[model samples]
Target chain A: MTTSKNTDMDPTAEPEEAAIAPETQPREVATIEQRAAAAGERGAAAVADAIEQGEDAEKAVGVLYLGIDLGTSRTSVSASNGQRETIASYVGYPKDAVSQKLLKKRVLFGQEALDKRLALNFFRPLEHGVLKSSEEGTPEYEDNLRAAKDLISEVIRRAKPRKDELIYAVIGVPAQVSINNKQAVLDAARESVDSVMLCSEPFSVAYGLDMLDDVLVIDIGAGTTDLCRMHGTMPEDADQITITFAGDYIDNKLAEYIRETYPEAQFSIEMIRKIKERYASVADEVDKVVVDLPVNGKPTSFDLTDGLRAACQTIVGPMVDGLSTLVSTFDPEFQDRLKNRVLLAGGGSQIKGLDLAIEREMATRLGGGKVMRCEEPMYGGAGGALKVAHDMPAEFWEKLK
Target chain B: MTEMTTAKAPAASALSVAQMLHLMRMEVDNAKLHGYAICCLMIGLDEFQTQAEREARRWLMPAIFSELKAITFQQHIRGLGLTREHFILAVFPHIGVKQATELSEELLAKARELELPGITGGTPVTISVGVGHNSHPRSDELETLIEDAETGLNLARSGGGDRWMQWRTVEDELEDIRGELDEQIREMRELGPGEESDAVASWGHALVRKIVDAFAVVEPSASLNQVRSDVLAIVSSEVDRWRDLATIRQLSEREKTIDLLERRITKLTGSLDQTESELKRIASLKAIDTGISSIYSTVQGLLDGEDNTEAKREMLKDIFEANLALRQ
Candidate 1:
């Protein structure tokens, strides 16, 4: 494929033909809002400033398209107004009047909430691609729903959309999410955006890369590992497998083993999660995993190399097991092709040597296989969802609105 | 709180309205950049028009203005100016219209106690102050802001000079409304979908729609629905495909056992080797560790047809079947 950048007008070109070309575009003021949306971080202050520069202060026109990946552990967004941000899937509300006054906020989000967790009633709204409290008509469920909505809105606002601009967004959820959960996601988004749509997370990843044929996308999320087979079409449920032995499971397993080895060691799930994120590998040889934890109120270093590796390796069994099933059942003619194009995505795929480990596992059990990790694991789903939003026809967007 | 800075006392002594405008602009600009509100106060000396009062004005005005400035300075008011017969003050850094009203009330009370020299207690230099906050003051909008403050001063003078009055410009009022709407939107988001009372939620929905319409967003929901329907259609087709595939049972009963036998043998041998190594290490080093290493480095659960491994195939089939059932 040849890449072309148009610089000048060809006077002799056929007028009608050139008019229909996808390369052609209409000229406009190229306002700061447009440029910011294109660049992606344009926030409220920036929008306020941009609107001040408009020729007509009363009317500034723009559209901000957002693609959101609402994961269990982290929420990510890519906006047309050139903003991209990710925050932990955590929400916090001040415990009482004193804390509220001290914090100077009624509700806190993302890292701010995590840092000030002691004064907050913390809630993580998502679990396994849906609201943790997705049940009907309960206070806890309502509270969690609120948290999810706030988190979604916070991520969207992080894009810094102009109040004058239309916001249309597409969100990616787990491929097999229930209709009710999908409805909840849609409802949450409706308040924050003009129109919204939902797509399968793994499919969005595939769509983002334009890899629609004979490809296997294994998205290892915090709560689940989703394996989707793309054979030049929308993958059916039979072609996708979701297993729960993912990032969170690895964290818990690592914590369990560490406790067994160092009974007196003081640690938290949060601490273990950080350690895993920093140094998770399933390889036989790894750098020395030395970490310090309090034991009897004294900090001590422990050699947890084996424990970490063992914990990281636990997911390998279930993932490969699922991969093997998807591969064997595919059309026999394209089975080899599918085996050769395993694309690893999601936060869990960030584990060092994971692709290699999966590859090795595939070869030993399934004749031969290849595994490749996404370049930007954390943003892959969001990027894909954005692509889906971009490629979706105008009619689809209109119908949703 | 009578701690007026000696340095600023000279500036307010004979400051012109033009000089006051320039200084007020700088202070307002700084406050705007830091997201703080600043209020402009226009105070008029009530009975300075009579010939006798005019003769006493020069000495009486400075003393009264100086006293007022001194009183405001103690309250941490940031700027002060005197323009002809009008005394102006800019109080800043988060002092909104509400706080500005309170400051005006306090100033009026203090002005009544100021005993003008050569006048005894004859009217006591009762002054009226008009207060206006520089709301949403863009660079060009500062001139309008000063006019709005002046209008407030005129209102107080007409309503009888002994009282304090405050007014916000129309633009400032709109900005306040916008701020309130934004805050409401934030609260609505915090409430989540379907959790808020229906009436409030409905209003939020309508507000969001109006906002979207104002932006002229082209709706893409129909296409979005189309894409969703396509995904659902694929699901239906695949289900039909699975039904066709399910009817065929390829592997023989004998083949399934052999596959299971191979796995059991591999597992037992690996465990035996691991036990031997652990024992040797403990005997030699006297280490008291009980960490069990996993046996298979790579997954051996797939059916590699060369070994006629039926059990692994069965496992894959079972998993696939379970997934299919779940989808159904």
Candidate 2:
């Protein structure tokens, strides 16, 4: 793992640097390669320790490690050792002279690559509920795959898996990724990871939460909206549906509407996104405030009370309608109970009035039920992956990515 | 400034004057994207190059500085360094991307030549100049005049390239853009004697009257765009068969339902319960598509064709299949 570029700084670390933390003040003519070799050794030691912990069979420590939250908007990865994270499911490039010089680069990804957003070109890797890909000969082809690869690679880098450990990653694919899409994700992940196993994102969330018995998991993020009905066993395809309208949909609609009303305002794909995250509210607010909007070269404030209210409430109706449909798919005996337990996860679930809004709409549909938000914000998916790793054998784990 | 004059000259490079304008617009737009405000435009001229038949140029080739300096004799004028943030130099590759490069000195000389207010020159004035804001944010017409020096230099040279030119204060030129947009909107209101009238705008004036007389409420998904589309085949064909067309009234009703559906969509994003409702809705809609198409078409065929009981019975079976699929 010691890259050629690293040895010129540590010529003599090649011999004595093999020991722990002893590379400092060694040979006079050290080359970069020797230093790089030292770095690789340290990396190897960390992996050995992580792998040892993963192999633990006792209740306190299980060597099997995992990370997953197959998301509607984006997928997140976490390991048993508490490393890794979320990857934005988008990729794009600058289009024209304006965009080319401004970005100073060709392509961008995740939150960064929103296409030629600066009046140039832009593309999203996942549109609606499926992979956003086109025929290889088409112009839109390589971009989406490139983004997915970049995202997976970034997640693996975050996990910091070691060379010797039997690295296994069980990634949660969208319930809608289709068998074909799941296979594609696994193939894409093959390069950065040792092995791959695909699981339904929603079910993975429920299993992570230990709510497999009579529960529902709704993972809402920037990309898509997903609902999973969980029973004692792994949920089936009939139990899930990925909706196109999620956080981004609302943001875009708001942006379109706002642009017409305030034509001079300089609205961006990012600022509006941050604004949605910051102040988008559905439930009745205690403190109503006007947001200052940048219009034409100046700042203009508008009473966003009604606009925010309407925009935030946009997803509520579809969610309720979907929930009502999902409940009927449950066992006849648990129909009423399923109505009582709803679990909301993912970033969009963090909206202030989200649970209350959901519960209100649901109560009208199902007579009454409790809509619950997950406590963990960033780690639920990773936590779930870790849980899976703890029980499964290392070899089985290696099959998942 | 009567009718403006542009001396049409074949461009000295592939990047024509229009291309330069577009490029500047793009750059400004890009800079604005990074949240930067650029409120000025500046151009400089190299008059000596304009005069000589074998025009020698400076500001680009530094390795042959002695050769470049020979062409720039009016080096008597000394100056201050223009800041980078306020400046963007668009000279040839002979100069390169960096101002520190060799070919950059000619542009640098011209920029430095212009002191705080202005710079004076002798009769050897070689390059015709134009100075105006090429749509840079902070410019008005006066600043645009400064920018117009490039255009003037081109016009002076009969549309050849401009030398050192700078856009003066553009407080006035920006009004032309605003005025243009304002005129467009005003024209949209049907102000002129000969301008074409817009029905959408003309009819919208009497708000309450327009509502009372409203005849069409277009459907959300049903549009002229849906005419040749296969996605609407069943829906459109059913309309043809049953004569239960998607008329203005039904379209209005559909629009209302669609609006209602959007609210439910918003509600559904936060809760899982709405999933069932959505599925049910889709199922019902799909059923409606099948029924309205197959049943109406089948009955119409039976009535128009054999006009027999047996044909009607077969039609009933077809209707049954469509109904069963929808109900499930």
Candidate 3:
């Protein structure tokens, strides 16, 4: 029988670097081609191992792996077929007969739904990073369930899976999603994929980056900021936290400041969102934020730099406070390692100067620290989830299916 | 006589003219943001060089600086500065003009009350005070903030020494802004008993009112951008529907009003675009756009020794446990 290593070992075991601990050294360089070849070799080896373990090896050939980050604002997917897609997580149905006739479609998705919302019954199925599971038997709850299913199916369809291929998906969820919520997500995803598993969003990010240990992952999505500390092991309940102070909160705060400062100007949440996405920062010298809103039916310009900065700064204190708690409570030997490997992921992580701000806070609050921004803020979770789907063994897939 | 070169706590704590200017500029933003008030007070000892003895000036200067610094400790002052014969004090989180005036009077009283040895009687070493504060924080009247203080000082000195005066801007800025808004509303209303422009006027009035209502609550939770965009969407759709109606009938009056309303709508949309570009400019200040792409298409094992696999798996299990614990 073929056996694979399953014991804790130094990740950096190459003889040239044997003396250095894995967490202290930079990751080894592997070219894209090299990594791909290794992955292909591993895939074949894993299949052979499965066969020896009395599993069906032939069933794996046409199986596709999908990693999905189902978020409140946007749903992103990275698939084995080399397709990555992100869409606004919204679904809309025609409001009435006349509008239905005009739109010529029963339902719309993403930006289309957002644009045509006036004539459609718009639904955002997820809120704060979970399926909006309302009280059962209520129409609102049923509608949310339907919307959630439709949204998942639509996102899968966007992956362009071949009809002959079996689909296996791993979805990244909030670190502390309820069991009922996970079941609801699994139920929604099962309709479209052959097998599915849910993983913590931050864990998925860490897995994707190959920083599985001695790292603190902060995935700041629209609805929540999830913090996870990895110590060469999967993070435990004590190693994670989910705070609601995130992108959505920043948007609301920015909008509020604009409203108060320019009482004669008219604006909307979408506009405020644009402001947050484009101009959000917590730095000493960010450029001026000036935008125009209609006033007395005339366009008037107002500077919003102060308000945007203030709103953006709101998350820093809370996030650093959370980071302090996570860092202080870790094994004292690994606490410094955890602080030094702070990883920023998710859409909210795209806010400018946030990594530096967090790092600065960490130094003051935790004695000293380091923070690294994920190369892909928008797709970090989705990419990590995809990695999870790929790493999952064939037997787990079969069992889950 | 107080020693001129002697460093007292308040005068020693004083920043340079440059530093004080910088601090005032920084605090102006905070004052504007939190809806508080700030004012700069410029006090000049009236013609000290020509009036007092060169030896007397050394002791007199420190006495003047000391008293000025002492007054700031009594008020909500942010910083105090000395430039030659003049002293500038910046007061912040200001209560109002009345409080500022009372504080200014106290400062003047304290200056005249100073016990100077070189000069006697006739309100020895009289000082002229000038104060300037803004009612609206958004106004960039900062360049003239110091100038206003200077002007008020000039007025105080000209109107005889030992007195203080507050500068009143020649034009009422808030009133001017209101007048401009009213004028625009009047012009839009003048579009006259027509359907398209009237609808535009109605939406316009409603939009303005909504903006006004937004000012009542400045909570970060309130999303004014959403309200603005929603109103714009409605107005734009209405304008589109009206344009189609006018196009089909070719009613001259309807077309004319539609044209006028369309221009207004275009103007409104143009401002949003300008605002977007402005926001973009701010965004460009940071390294935000260069999002890094991950190289790994699939999950790869850690670069660990063979012996560590079990520990790695154990960690993964712990993560699952933490995640699962949420259900519990």
Candidate 4:
């Protein structure tokens, strides 16, 4: 392995495998005696050590609180393995009546539940974050909560917490989760955990980033683009705003535009999103992007260069306008700080020309400052919670519940 | 050993810490997704869960590829450059737990078209989250913030599944009462137990005085008895679980003879018995008679609790002679 050259040497073989040296190795008695004695002692000691370890291996149970991040698209559960993430967040659901009878369970969770969604009801429970009926105390609303409760409970049970472990949680709420809807989710969550607390989605990202200082976070989400301003320690009414113009907005616009251009183009919303993700750009690059769209049940190609950019840029105007005002509300001096220190922490920041666009707009307003994106958007929020859990004194947790 | 190459994980379960991170990030990207906090459960599935090398590689390969993904975090460890965030970890799930936690695969495949802001690649970004208040509350908004996230994770564990959550629960109500009871019970630890009960029987103690002692009757018990009682209680409450812990510990030890023999045969995974036999065989070579074998026997005897310490020391000389005789 060291030299690339194949050096053939063998001890448990004939003379050809290994050359006998002119000077043979003298099997020293004294050294062999020493090793024998040492090995003897070591073996005895190893036995004693093993016995001791066996006796001490009994696991002691302690009360541990857990936090779960169950996003519509994926799920993550946290508990103490030194600190959080002690188990994989997963649930298992029976695929059919036969499966249900065989398994004697309704649903599984995490990867197990997710991978087999097609065979089950696959209820995400939240459509655009609230009951589609848009009313409170309805049956669909209640069924959703019940389903959510079942899923969460299974995920928690998977964590295998002690009977003595005091489990509590704080959940991240979408910025636009209506007060009634938020309360309903909280009420449902209340059934599963010992305690529950709610905070904003973008704010959670902001909090994760330690962006407590003046900063702006534009969380570009599926159904919405939320702009939040953090001044001092917490977000106030004027500090945050959620607009229905994020990824989903772009998808809808892109679908409409593409459909307008090619009436026979066979495509779903997902296809357009893929096309946008591949070719959509806000910067002035007019390169053509060719994609296959199903035409009358067959595939056809189209060049969507200008249209992609136009669609991708749709959310920018509203988001920029909202964040601009939020920035201006801060003191003039702090506005400069906020603009320059603009921290784009959500999925929206992944847009190719987003940072540039924000930088350009902010530069015109506050002279010159840069907009930065978080490196790990996936864990940006959870990592913040972990950071808080690790850094804060244990006693601090005692007072929060 | 077969030299067949295998991917770093099984095709079915591609779970890893890095994948968890990517998924959580994708949740943050969802447009309609709202939550108070987030939680991520990262399992070191590589070394622990992998039953076969082929399956192990399959699970681990995606992570290597994800790390090699041309965007975001890949810039830090390799290829293009990006600065480390002071080696910090972030928790971003507190606000959106109430809504959008149960993002479907239907959604993930079409996230970009759905205009879901979070999903960058085809990989879905859903986290099973629950919302709850911290049992140990803190006034610092940051502490409260963490408490909310922690509670959500707890709920997720307990079945606050598929979707996000953001609120306190009925269980929270009970814990509040328990917290108050604990506070009251703290004052009682000061007054000793059995002595107070004795005084009460003697008609010299007040009811309040006895109540002030947390365990007036049990406190006077012997320490050994206390330990036995505690162990028994653990076994009783947990039933087979606490009892099975002892057995699992026993299995983790290397004292099993079969295991030793296998390790010796394989050259990498043998146990103590094989080592003893190998040593005895080597010691029977020329110039060395059975003297080295005697030493091995002595060592084995010591392990068997032989009390002949002085005789064992003297036997060392004969063993040394046998070793020297073999070399010459």
Of the candidates shown, which would achieve the greatest TM-score relative to the real structure? 1
Q: Candidate 4 docking: what grade?
A: incorrect
TM-score of every prediction relative to native = 0.51, 0.47, 0.50, 0.44
Residue B280 lDDT in candidate 3: 55
Model 3 complex DockQ against the native: 0.03
lDDT for A63 (candidate 2):
28
* lDDT by residue for model 1 (B1-328), tens: 1233222223333444334445656666777677677776666777577777766554544555565566656677655454343344343445677777777787777767766446644666677777767653442234445555665666566656887765454335445545554554455456432322344435545654564564455556878657656655665565555444432322233346446655655565555555446435534543343211111111112224423234323422332343334334
lDDT of 3 by residue, B1-328 (tens): 2232234423333343345445566666677767677776677776665544544544555566566555556553545344342344444445466776777787677666666543543545677887777763434244455656666676677667688776564224334544554565576677554465456556666765776577557654347667666766776676666655654555576567667766765665565555446445544644333221222323333444634567656654544444345334
Native contacts, share recovered per candidate: 0.00, 0.00, 0.08, 0.00
Winning candidate number (DockQ):
3
lDDT of 2 by residue, B1-328 (tens): 0011011211223443234545445544554466433322232333443433112222211112222223222333211111111122232111112221222335344333322111123222222223333234444222232334333333333334333333232224334444554554454455233212233223334442443344235443566345425434544454344333334445566567656655554444433334335435534742342100000000011122322335333423332332233223
Query: lDDT per model, in order?
Result: 0.67, 0.49, 0.68, 0.46
Model 1 lDDT per residue over A1-401, tens place: 00111111111221111011010011222445544564456444455665686643323345556779999988888765456688889899988643453354778887678777876899989998688874767998888889999899888877666666667677988878787777778777888987677877898788767677889999988877888998765677898888888889999999999889889899999999999989998887889999999898899999989999999999998888998999999889989999999999999998888888888888899988988888778778888776555545455456567
For candidate 4, lDDT tens digit of each residue in A143-207? 67776677667545644554534555545556656666666666666676654555566666665
In candidate 3, what fraction of native interface contacts survive?
0.08
Residue A151, model 4: Cα distance from true site in angstroms: 4.6
TM-score of chain A of each: 0.86, 0.74, 0.84, 0.71
Give the range where candidate 1 chain A is weakest over 10 consecutive residues by summed lDDT.
A15-24
Return whichever of 3 and 4 wins on DockQ: 3
TM-score of candidate 3 relative to the true fold: 0.50
Scored by lDDT, model 4 comes in at 0.46
User: Each prediction's DockQ?
Assistant: 0.01, 0.01, 0.03, 0.01
Any runs in candidate 3 off by more than 4 Å, and if so which?
A1-61, B1-308, B311-328
